[model samples]
Target: MKGLLPPPGAVRLLSIGGLVRTTGFGIMTSISVLYFTRSVGLSAAQVGIGLTIAGGCGIAASVISGRVADAVGARNTAITLVLIQSLAVCGYAFVTSFTGFVIAVSVVLSCHSAAEAARGALVAGLIPAEGRVRARAYLHSVTNAGLSIGAVSGGVALQADTQGVYVGLILACGALFASSGLLYMLLPQVEPVAAPSGRGSWEVWRDRPFLLFAGLNAILAANDTVLVVVLPIWIAQQTEAPLAVFSVVLIFNTLMVVLFQVRASKTTSDIPGGARAMRRSGVLFAVCFALWAFASGQPAWLAVVALLAGAVVHTLGELLWGAGAWTLAYEMAPDHAQGQYQGVFTMSTQLETMVMPVAGTMLILPAGSLGWLLFALLLLVAGLAAPAVARRHTNRHTNRQGTPSWN
Candidate 1:
């Protein structure tokens, strides 16, 4: 049993590291806009524009960092990025002007995106092929737990509403991010795989199949927007369910992921298995959305019932989606360029996230039931396409010689 799991010490360090890092992350995620608008005197429009610019930089940095990870070492690149990110986050405290805010946040977002890609590569190097996805699942649970705690703490700061408290919290978040970098230093380092070919430059961009896979992942990744951005608004304005339903549903979803994410990931051990899990998740998503769609304009009790059912289904779908995405991202990537591959994967989701604020609000918000139905169909199509894409990649890559050892 001991042999089957990651070393206990390694797992313990990783767990503590994830918990601490995301606790800060959770704080910022909930209150950064409030700090900008209230304390810093930046307009909501200014903040949005700044985020738009920063998101673009984040998208670019995702791949840039990955390439850097391959060029240097993943751990080295991760440490450098997070350290720079700490400084950028600290700069947020002084962002009285929109330009200052944009510059600080741009650097912070770039570092965040890059560090994630680098860390992905680092994890690949640290964990065995068979256990990477499971390890990722456990980390997800830990990070979410941290986020829960951070969100609560951020709520306290919000209640305080003083500039000094906000600034103090922001500084503390920067420190936590820096602490995460120190944790990276503590972990045993993974050796950089030597690049043997001249084609090492942006090799992931040239792979057409991976590009398609990445595109599909972007669609699947919308599961995130659906949870955080879209669901609350829809429940508030479109559905007859009480607004409180969203809060409950969110808590339910979080708890389910914290408890069952690793268990669900057990099915997603390999590429074919992951693709299948993704396909199933798509069906579940479609069903969940359908429930929500029909909940629109229903009686309050009926809508509440539908929303709770939808939450249960949505969480299940999310669990499967997380596992599948992790496995596909890890296994399809060649050993030497895990960072590049992960960057591209992360970029897809980042690009989606960057656009989703305006797109989800403008397109999905006003459309009501029809919008939900249409989004459901899009997910269904992506889900159906996943297995086909995975099968094609497998056929193209697998040779008569046997399964490629790199996977």
Candidate 2:
């Protein structure tokens, strides 16, 4: 366990910081749709559109943040973003109209996105390469745990009337950002890696392996978004189960991450098999979708059982794939351009959020089964293709550098 983990102090600090950020993020995300659609009186389609717009803004902010971090230093960049996030949450409380809400949400989302990029760059700066995967896993575990706690607390606060609900939630988010900002301030100053002479974001995009990973990740992210949005709607439509069932499933997922991620991370961290890990994860996700397809036709009780099983499997895949993905990002990135690489990786996920709703909506329409089948096929392709791409890139780099193939 010790070997798999980051140093105890770094782990402790990162965990606490993750806890604060994820708590705020969980509370906000869990309620944003409700707040916008129900409390603020927007239509469902409008809410979706708003989210898409905010996600787009977030993508832009993430890229800009990475560049700013490279220019001004990661810690300073992080602190600035954190402050912006805090103010944005407070702005959420004042959004009385749809236009105001959209603007406010966009601001908040952009700041949150920038903060996330900064956080990733900060992690890359602080942890050694060998310890990075485990560090990311541990950080994710703490985040999941914090999110579980925050979800419950937010539920309680949201049970109050609309005004009270938004007020309470925003206050909680603001406090968390403030706490994260303090933690960022206290972190030991990590010197920025000097930028390479000719590298830029466009050059990073030209790397074939990186592009392949990003493309596959975008697909996986689309599916993940479906699970968040479409699945819940499907469950509500088909089952007598309470809406809280989704929350319970999420709680179970978070619990598994908190309990097992460290151990699972340890086994895989030093394996030098990023591509294989990704393929396995894609297979597992395909299985999850397969289960979901079957469960869609089941009786309510049977559906619940199937959903639970699928959730467990999917969460395990997430743990494995997430660790591998971060490790690959860290490894593939040149030391001098870590921020740019990390930003691009983060951008793929954010891009997924933007694409998911439109794609999921199209799939669930007249040709729903086709949608599922297409999704399954895409995952299988990603599973097969990632490793092949990785090997090809590895061979190319080795040849260019005159290094041993195994290294």
Candidate 3:
């Protein structure tokens, strides 16, 4: 394997761009509900509907953007999307009705989603394979840091007025768009890889290991949604703690990402075994869920302690799964079809987004215990199965080459 480090310049540019974009996203998301309800005078149901529509449109846009990246080049595609996204943010200021607000938000969400796919593909295109995972980790770390700051600042901005919120978002969008342009200039222009003979999206299914990875990723992604959506609801319903305590937990989670993600990346870099890392992450996540379950039984103070412990475990799993997953995606992809493969991989997260609402509802229903239990069981199964699948896949590859191997 090549040395497990990205070019210093590439790392710097990608991390900076990631931070700026995440900050913008965080700022906007932090106030979206309030803005829609108060500023646009939308009912709660209308806001939910708008969010649903926006999410569906965003997924479709992400899929299309991957193809656009392949056609026009990742850097150019990203630049175009960011520009549109910036305009969309500014357009929010003009929204005076429910319909207009939905349209503006949908446009912005779609552009942001598309830009994210382009950025992921761009990073994969630029960084060396051995270091891609760590590079992505660095990006994630910077993104989390930016999000923490933006979320806080967004709340402060909202205290001013509707106009102030719109102005703040507009500036946030402008900064992100400008950062995208600068990053584009810094990234070395490289020709897209030639398409493989007779290659198509269907060909990706031929790789069993990659398919398995995607399935496992979808499950993990569902868990991620639970963390963001369900956990807070559960906390509020079960404890006397203020909602601000949930914010404190999130801050701790983000702080860990900012401080420890890179270190975790380096630690996982030399493993040469994505399945092993994934298994470890799975175990940690199981423990995290167990801690969360225990939290329900504790007093408020102990509940906070449980929440913090669970957050640490969950964050560790996040670091491990992230570094491992991207590395596996990069390694399994054929040289000529990286963009297509990356697009398919990116779709797994989209699928997760779609599944989250359903899963969250199921988990909090009358059979909540059973729901959490089932979720935990699924994670354990995926974790246990991954290493075996990896070993089998490796052995099969070796056998095809007529070589004995210890996978």
TM-scores, all models, native as reference? 0.95, 0.89, 0.89
Q: Write down the worst ten-residue block by lDDT for model 3.
A: 398-407
What CA RMSD would you report for each candidate? 2.7, 3.1, 3.5
Pairs of residues clashing in candidate 3: none
lDDT of 2 by residue, 116-146 (tens): 7777778878888887777788887787777
Q: Please give the CA lDDT of all the candidate structures.
A: 0.85, 0.74, 0.73
Winner on lDDT between 2 and 3 is 2
Instruction: Give a tens-digit lDDT track for model 3, residues 1-407.
Output: 12322346987787777777778777887877887677767899998888888888887787678777776688777778888887788787778888897899899889888877787778777887777777888887787877877788788888876756666676666677666666677788745777767766445668777788778877766667878887888777765456677777777777777777766766554324676677777887787877776677578888888877888888888877777667666766666556556766777767778777776766543345455666777777776676666665655555334342224
- In terms of lDDT, which candidate is stronger, 1 or 2? 1
Which is the better candidate, 1 or 2, if ranked by TM-score? 1
Model 2 ranges with Cα > 4 A deviation: 1-7, 33-46, 200-202, 238-248, 270-272, 299-305, 364-370, 399-407
lDDT of 1 by residue, 1-407 (tens): 34223357555567677788889888987789999999888899999999889989999999999988887788889888988988888898888899899999999999989987887888888889998898888888887789999999999779988889888998999999899889888888777787667864888988877888889889988878888898898888887788998999989988888888888889887888888888888999999989998888889999999999999999999999889988989988888889899899889877778767677888877887888889899998998888888877788785535562222
What is the overall TM-score of model 2 with all chains considered together? 0.89
